[model samples]
Target: MPESELGGPEEKSYTAPGKVPLDSGWVDVPRLSLSASAGPGAFGGEERPFDNFRFSQRWLREQGLDGSHLSAITVEGDSMEPLLRAGDEVLVDHSPQPFRDGIHVVRLEDTLLVKRVAAQGGGRYSLLSQNLAYPPLEVNAQDIEIVGRVVWKSGRL
Candidate 1:
């Protein structure tokens, strides 16, 4: 990854894959995408917000996700910072694909950590913190349970 793709605390040296480094001076996060974005009201149609109840219960269930397949968990901490602030609502894709290097809510050991996935190191994985104050934490695969991938973060604009 390019130097710009990597970021973290000034005191930590986290050499993880797909890591977006956070520094005291690097506070500006832009709209980054691997592909071009669809502009508002111009991508054939406007994007619609997910109706939590129907989207999570009936629709998603009808789409093949059983009752045990999903749940709405209110985010409770600032460990995720700007990307996933406390009180924000995030839809957890319970029936998620195999753990990959991306964002996900993970229950490692006894702690539930909502951090950006960094790498899958055979028996362990690296979790990146959006806030520089919190250094990256390494958790063992066996000790961690993959909750789900964070589909989208919704909150006040």
Candidate 2:
């Protein structure tokens, strides 16, 4: 038999199997999402794959994202609903640079919010809400922190 074919149909590691796992960590500019999908029926004994619980801590570490310069968190609140649905995912860029007028994941005194940020300057900016019921806000440099700019947004299609 050919060596390749002799390797248990070329897929299964039936003999002396090895195990490897994934580790994910969030650091600066965290707009990471852990999404999972599954089929309706069972074709074989295999289980459906789950979404990423966390990104590779090693990857983030090697890339230096775990430092104070970057961070990522799940979004909450309905303020950014129309453009950023409650469950949709976002990536934050925390390098502290000028962002073109758009949305961002802002962190204030005890709260983390995802809102549309219209840049003002010198650590100040305007927060606009897609929902008119909630009025826009003008924030000062000290009032809040820019965790990261929203780099991307994704959701169910």
Point to the candidate with the largest TM-score: 1
Residue 123 of model 1, lDDT score: 89
- The TM-scores of all predictions, comma-separated, are 0.55, 0.52
Clashes of 1: 6
Model 2 RMSD in angstroms? 12.1
Each model's lDDT: 0.53, 0.53
In model 1, the runs with Cα more than 4 Å from the true position are 1-52, 56-68
Cα lDDT tens digits, model 1, 1-157, are 3344455444455446433334322211122111110111011122232333323244444555443454444455566677766666665567746667777767655455567877766787887877777777777777767767766556676
